[model samples]
Target: MNLSVVIPAYRSERWVGRAIRSALAEGVADRNVIVVEDGVLDGTAQVVQATGARLTSLQRNGGAPHARNLGLAQVDTDYVMFLDADDYVENGLLAGLVGALERERADVAIGPWVYDGDGRERGMLRQPPALDNAERIFHWVMHAFFPPCCIAWRADAIRAIGGWDERLRKDQDGELVIRALIRDLKVAVSEQGNGVYWQHDSPHRVTKAQIKDVMYAADVVFAQLEGWVRSRIANGSAGDERVSLGRFCCKTAWVAYAYGDSAAGAKWSAKARELGFHNRGYNYRSALLASVLGIRISSRIKASTRLVYRRIAQR
Candidate 1:
């Protein structure tokens, strides 16, 4: 196998097969598609088999990276990439990505990632401000860097870094790439275009449920990322790690509140407030970031925040 394309399937029965087929069919190269079902409620394994793609099953749900590494370790592909079971790849995506990797002889190949709904583009995960001739991947972590799905990596390079850490539920991709950069790995960027990242938004669109879960994950991830920043500062890298850590803290704060953990979330909100992130609607993102920093939103501030809250209550 020259390429291993791993899809971590979790409750993705609606389109797990489609995601697999897209990997096998539209990819520009000969790569094996492995769909790892994480103890799903639906017949996700059956769906993978039905598509004639290889299937791997875990006895329980262990999040994305865990499912990915199971399939990843079994293959001998020269390169590896990941895709969420719910996401579908686009035409020319695989070929364009592979060509760039080969041309640059890069340990990893990256590109712009556009976020989309089932049929339309919703947003995009921006490439870093820059990937300088001499760059620091750790500095430009994309929520979690080198988006796992939008990237392809030399298999040996994957091993050299010991593969994805199964511990991370949210920012594993970013964590992995930064580790690679610390080892001074060479990464390539493609000029083909942004690869589509299909986001399965809620039909309700603005329910408490939708935003709540998002906050839960963000809260957890930011805590881990803070530790990562501290370790970096200890190593004497660049300016203050506080700036980055503070930014993540504020973002996690609002999500924590959205997810119904207002008490826990309030802590993040207050920390963000203390950090001086007081921009209006931007405060929504701020509230969540503050939550991660672990401080409480004063009852007085919470009461005041309610007046503006009604204007956007439905969403």
Candidate 2:
């Protein structure tokens, strides 16, 4: 199958070459490697041009979604895959994903990915079995899956859903895939690991520094999900599937507290309570403390506990 790979790059001169090389190594021709440079001329454009990949340089930084949409508009192949500039896919990843899609006649095919950085394997993000229904896909989204790098899509299928949400600065992949699943498209999952997502701890990375933007995106995603669930319930198509809004809210609350946004944390925890989510797991203690002492005080207590534990350990 003819496949086109899109890599959205910004200040990625250091690793964008490797990403392009990885795609080319998968037997994808140079003409099919499209790199959308998001207005950062940090020598990334030079590297991409040197590799002979088709380069589309935007006038200014428009974030990943914009770059991806721009790249999507340029796709002319049967299948398409996205690779972040800092990450590289394993050999044959494109062929593996395309083969799975063709064999299953699926609109999308996904494979497992490993999270690694600084020359060490951190862990794996495994794709669940083939999801055929909206409810199952919704459940998967509530848990925050990895990025879109692990999947390949039938180019037309993605266009049918209007591509990614350009307004979202984060969680764009989850939002896009969730809409596709809600539209009742078929999905095939390959258990074979094929992708690598580099985890960067640098504060410059959006994932590391954009907590507020991420939380805002989360709210939009969950709101859409809640609407979908309501629609499913109204149509009587929701089977044994339960909407895990409470769990989602609790998780969001924890994230807010961890990011030092106590007001947001308390608000989300209250929302979870309203949704009938009983904090029954590791969140139980923190939930209770946040409820009684407010998230700010509760967070302080937790921080002190961690500090004390570390001091004791060093003794």
Candidate 3:
């Protein structure tokens, strides 16, 4: 099968070369490596040219969603994978994902990934066995287990889904996966750890430091999922819909709290509770704090705690 690897790059001069080299080393003559340079002032363009990859340069920075969409427009391959410029994949990533897709007759296949951050390897990001359907895949995605680099999509399937949402600056990967699952697309999971997600303390990484933007993105995703759940219930496919929505609310609440958005945390947690989701562990703590201290005060507490933790880590 022909595969196209698209790398969305923005100010990624430090790692773009490595990313391009890794994609080239996949050893598929039919494979195409397209790098979308999202208005980089750095030497990212030079690096892409050096590697002889097809380069699409945007006049201004438009985020990963826009860059990926631009890259998708140029794709003529049977399968496509979006690899971030700062990330790399194992040698057999494309072959393994394509093999799984063919064997399982799946429209999309996901492999395991490793997290490399702070000059060290964090660990492997592995999914549970046999996530073979829409509901299970949505559940895993809501919990943030799915990353874009580890996923390969049938070109036709992605085109049918209308590609990525260019409006979202964060959580676009999750949004795309949610859309796929809502369409009841077949998903296959592979055990091979072939994707590497490089996380560094770079201020240029927009998503890493934008807590408010993250919360807004979460709101967008939850709204989309809510609409999908309603449609599913209307169509009599309401299996685990309530539970899944509640779980998603709970997860989003904790993330909001962690990100110093106590108001959103409280709102989502209250919704989860209204849906019969019980408080448990750290979630209970977040819900209680949001309820008792109110949004402004609870947010202050969270921010202060985060500052203290960062200071301690710096020492």
Candidate 4:
């Protein structure tokens, strides 16, 4: 099967070249590796030209989601994967994922992945198991714990969902997955190959965005999900959409706390409680701790402990 890789690059001259090479090294034709330069016009385009990969440039600076949608519009292959300019695929990874999609007749195929940050391998990350049931799929999409590189999509399936949500500056991948699963798209897992998500402390990293802006973008995403889920319920869908949204709020509270925005964290924690989501262990822990020491103090303690744990894990 013919597969294409669409990499969205924005001021990523330092890493785009290597990302393109990794995709090309997957035995894909150089022309099949498309990089959409997101209007930065930095050395990123020149690097793409040097690698002899197909290059598409936006006239204005759009975020990765826009760049990815533009790149997707140009793909004519049977399958395509949207890879971040800073991340790359393992040899044969793309082909293996495509094979799984074909074998299982699935709309999307997700593969295993590992963390590569600070020039060190952080071991294999957890892979989602079979998404054979709607409940499992909903939970996975809601969490959106995996990066985009771990997934390959049938071009039409993504188009069916109207591509990525350009309104989001972060968590677009997870939001897209939520849309896809809600539409009842078939998903499968590929255990044969893996991708590497390049993590770093770069200020340009989307994850490093200002906390308030991040919260706004996240609110947009969850609001979109809420509208879709409410519609699903009106149509007699099986899942309790509020429960999923509650969990999402709980997770977003964690993000708020991670960035030292205890106010936003408290807001999200309250939203979760308002949704009647007191049973989950995640919500229970945060609510119990916040009620005692207050959100500010409790969040600081949790964030500090998580930072130490993450540092230890990276070692």
Candidate 5:
């Protein structure tokens, strides 16, 4: 199967070469491994050139989604994959994902990924539940995440959905894939392959920033999801997605609290209550704690605990 892997590099001269090498090691032809340098002259293009991979340099920095869309425009292969410049794939992972798409006749195939940080292995990311398409999408909207490197897409199917949303600097992959799935794109799970997602403690990294800004970014994504769920409910096409959404809101409230956003935490928790999702054990425990400590104090406690854990992990 013809496949193209697009690696977007932005000020990643130190790591882009390794990413390129990993893609090449996947048995993909050097010519088919394209690197789009996202308007950074930080020797990233030079690194790409050194690997003999096709390099497309942008004149201005336009974030990852824009770079990915530009890369998508150049794809002439039947299937395409996106690899962040800091992350890499295991050997044969690309081929395996493509094979899954072909064998399952799917528009998209997602695989598992392992976390690598500070030159040590962390753990495998949790995979989404095994469910039919509709149920799976609901679960995905609720919580699960598949990083961009673990996903391969039928080129045409991605193009049909207008590529990635360039407006989003983070959560672009999740937003794009969820949008595609909501459009009824056939998706398959590739259980045999996995990729490496490098975790960084640096706040400058986009992934780290995603966590810091989770309240805002998550609300944006969840708004879209909630609208879709409401529409489905109105049309009598939804099952228990309403309850799932309420549970999702409750979960997000915890995240907000952990991130030190008490106002947002209370907002989402209230939304969950509005949706009649207060009977769960965790919810009951959280409510008891909040009643005793107040939301702001509760958020401070959660944030402090997270900070301590992060420092310990960093050590």
Candidate 6:
């Protein structure tokens, strides 16, 4: 097979048909577009079957990482790309991605991602066509390299690095891409890609713990990163930059709020003061959280805090 498009679907009967049709319309001859149905109640497997794409239903919903891993095991193609069942590619996606990979002779090819809702593009994360491994890492600092639907990668590169970390609730894509980069995997960015990432996530989505902290992946990743920092301090790990500890108390505070532990959130926000992250964004979020909880902090105190936030914003 020339290319494999792996779509891990769960409860996506409403959109799976369109997603499969989009891939078939792309006209990649001998292409394998495999949709793994993860215990979907909405007949998502039947939808893919009707679209003429092969379907493999999982016994249960095993999260994104598990579905991707299953897809990887099944693909026989030289190159592979992941696509969520709810998202579809716009016109010219197949030609752009496949051609870009062939021309660049890269181990992995990525492209720009556009967030769409009800047939309208709302947000786009654009990327340069060509980049080195180091540049790819920095580029990822801004946005994810693989939009799941935007990457065409050599099968060997994925297998060698052992694929993704299934343990993470979110940011599994980033972790996989980072592992590929750290191993010096050759990669390229597509010149054009109209892949649409449908926005179905809400303010309170499921997290690693499946409770609060819908965006809890960052904090867990941070803890792991701290370990890297410590090992490096002891002069361990020859390569790998010591896990970048720029003091993200701002992010820590948000993580706290997401986990539904207001006290923990407040503690992190207060610590942000000591860490010099007493900024407008974090402060505003803190106040919002405080407001929702009906905290006893009065209006005058809120005003003072807001002023302090503005001062930090200036910096």
lDDT of 1 by residue, 1-315 (tens): 256788888778787877777777765233388778887567777777777777878878886778878888876767877887766666556666778778888888876666665544366555634464224432553243445557888878888878887755555666676667656678777755455565444442112234444555555555555555567668786454455445555556544554456776667656656655443223455345335542334333553576455434423
Ranking by lDDT: 4, 5, 2, 3, 6, 1
What value does the lDDT take at residue 295 in candidate 6? Answer: 30
Residue 103 displacement (Å), model 6: 3.1
Residue-by-residue lDDT tens digits, candidate 3, 1-315: 478888999999899888878767875442389999999678899988888889988889988888998999889988889989888887587788888888888888988787765555467566545754655655565544667768999988998998998877777887788778778888887776578888777787855747677777777777877888788789997787776777777777766776767788888878777766765313456558867875456656776887786555544
Better of 4 and 6 by lDDT: 4
RMSD of 4: 2.8
What does candidate 5 score in Cα RMSD to the true structure? 2.8
- Write one digit per residue (lDDT tens) for candidate 4, span 31-124: 8898999985678888899999999988788888888998998899989999999998885678789888999899898888888877456675
Q: In model 5, what lDDT does residue 307 have?
A: 79
lDDT score for residue 65 of model 2: 87
List ranges where model 6 is wrong by over 4 Å: 29-31, 119-125, 128-131, 142-146, 201-216, 223-244, 247-249, 258-315
User: What is the alpha-carbon RMSD of candidate 1 to the true structure?
Assistant: 6.4
Number of the top candidate by lDDT?
4
lDDT of each: 0.63, 0.78, 0.77, 0.80, 0.78, 0.64
Write out the backbone clash pairs for model 4. Answer: none
Q: Per-residue error at 59 for model 4, in Å?
A: 4.8
Query: Model 2, poorest ten-residue lDDT window?
Result: 200-209
Give stretches of model 3 more than 4 Å off: 125-128, 142-144, 278-315
**What TM-score, over all chains together, does every model reach?**
0.68, 0.86, 0.85, 0.87, 0.88, 0.71
Worst 10 residues of 4 by lDDT: 136-145
